[model samples]
Target chain A: MADTAKIDYKNIFYPPGGILLWIIIYLELLTFGIALVFMALNARTEPEVFHESRMLLNTAYGAINTVFLLSSGWCMAQSVHFLKTENFGKSKLFLKLTLLGGILFLALKSVEYYDKVEAGLTVGYNVFFGYYWTLTLFHVIHVIVGIVILLVLGRTLSKKPETLKVEDYESGAAFWHMCDLIWLLLFPIIYLLF
Target chain B: MERTFNATWLVLIVLTIISAVFANLDFAYAALIILGLSFLKFIGVAFFFMELKRANVFWRVLLVAFVVLLLTVVWAV
Candidate 1:
């Protein structure tokens, strides 16, 4: 079993993935949070346009992407759990599943983007589309970066699972979950709410 | 521990579906309801999936506070 006694819960610098990773997490959240707040404030000025633009978004697509990220996050958490337990095989398996979920999410998002462009719902379409393109595209970029991180982690796990530090694994998982969390905020405000 | 992760994932999925359905309907507080559901999912992921529950209380409080601040701003605006 893993040495739970070694964990320092009270130490501010000893959270999972170390304090440095936590700093990155906080900064990323703050950045996205500001963008979202701006979007909300703009929505207040043009409620009707916001509402109509929100209506044009496909809720089913947003919801499906949400599920993909959440499920992938679960796989990530599981992969970390298995790593801690020294179950390298299961850990690698779950890691692959996490990658699959992320790839699927990006694939679906590409399709959605294609449809939006074909319909002329480009970035310059309106204030709402501007926010929509900016926020979601920024989020998509994060997801792509997250997938690259996971890919590197997966390669290490395959080649040298024993050398993979639990802290590093947790950091990757934390980053992936950040993507999911941002989507959680974005989907509701941009797709559901006016 | 595995069971806890499984349960959290299920709850998150259920909440996502509920919020999607809520979004499709018209009501006075539909926005509030949908945003509220998203809030719960956010907590679920942060605490369970992110394993912040195992971290210091400071981290937990910081995350919760961030979400609350975001939601409050979104709702008020």
Candidate 2:
């Protein structure tokens, strides 16, 4: 295991997942941030529509999914930590837990989507659902990609732990946490706030 | 690192619950408080789970600035 303390964190090229992933992270956050700002502005123009549309959302599901994602994020961080400490067995276990969390979130989100569709709240339903579907569907795509990345990394780690670089593991964790962070942005503005 | 991550997760869950509770209450500032808690959650995940604490200062400050700018825009709207 490399000594994390010995590494010069001040180096622009040496974040946990490397500079390239950090760049992607920044760009991704900016994209979502701009969309959210637009949504807020749109809400300001039609507060009643936004408020009533928010009422149709199930806060319990949003809150529960937040727990699921956050817990998974914790597992991902733990997996990386164990990898750093050279505990491959525990690291693999945590990776599985993280995958489970992602799966649960996707499953629950599908149910929520189904409910909305049944209630005639599709993307073109109104401006509010327009933002809802676009922002969340974009986030869902990221989560799907994140899950695929984790699956690939988990396979490599399980079959050949020695072959998995710490950088690769950390990069996967970073992407997964990006999903968590984006959801944190979306949940409050969409489900809680009008 | 384990303790820190665990503690951070606990705080995030608690904050989520608090946000949910506040969502139930109708008040002018409930939205503000909930958004504030959400931003706090964002910071916790970025710093602890994403390991920004070990990153360069530029990355850390960039994230903080992003959150502040986002919060300001959302609040202004």
Candidate 3:
């Protein structure tokens, strides 16, 4: 009974090496919260300006991006599972799928930005446009970071299957999911709330 | 445990569609519902698909606290 209790305790509270990943995750969330507060205060001060400027955004593009990110998250989840089971081939395949999704998201986002530029909705046009472009561009930067991480992970999984690095994969996936989740909030706030 | 996508994925997909539909409605509280559902979907992805459900309670508490803090910040804004 004592041995069983010890085993249970170990399983419950003392994961061997997940602390670093958790700390990084917390810090990322903190940074996102700070940015959200900054934007919210800016919006509150100039509600009319922000609302009028928000009208220029394309909701369809925002929705499509949301779906893309969600699907990418799904694929990453599958890859994580496959990695855990040591199925290198399946893991590599799913990671490639995830990378494809990320690429597609970026391509669509670029097209959306191009459309905005052609329509003369430049960032310096107004305070709201400034915030809108800053926030969305900041998110786009994160997506780019996520894509790079996915590419690295895919490469590692394909080349060095022995060094699976499940934690790295999981952390990268978590970060990507965070990016997606934030956009899920931002999309509605920018496009639908008006 | 054998890896297989669960009902949560289906629920997330349905909620995403519902959120889009709700956005078009004339109801005053539709936005709130959409936000609420989005929060639920986020939690589902974090806990289930990310396998955080099987993680240590400390980690779970940390995540929940961070999310609550984010929600509070949003509310304050």
Q: Reference contacts recovered by each candidate, as fractions?
A: 0.79, 0.88, 0.31
**For model 1, what is the error of residue A28's alpha carbon versus the real structure, in angstroms, after optimal superposition?**
1.0
lDDT tens digits, residues A1-194, model 2? 33334456568678877788889998999999999999999999999999999999999999999999999999999999898888989999999999999999999999999999998999999999999999999999999999999999999888888778888788889999999999999999899998
Task: For each candidate, give its TM-score against the true structure.
Answer: 0.97, 0.97, 0.85
Q: Is candidate 1 or candidate 2 better by lDDT?
A: 2
Residue A126 miss distance in model 3 (angstroms): 2.3
lDDT against the true structure, each candidate: 0.90, 0.92, 0.72
Docking class of 1: high
> For all candidates listed, what's the TM-score of chain B alone?
0.96, 0.94, 0.79
What does candidate 3 score in Cα RMSD to the true structure? 4.6
lDDT at A146, model 2:
98
lDDT of 2 by residue, B1-77 (tens): 89999899999999999999999998889988998999899999999998898888989999999988997899888
Cα lDDT over the full model 2: 0.92
Name model 2 segments beyond 4 Å from true. Answer: A1-6
Model 3 DockQ vs. reference = 0.43
- lDDT at position B59, candidate 3: 74
Error of 2 at B54 (Å): 1.3
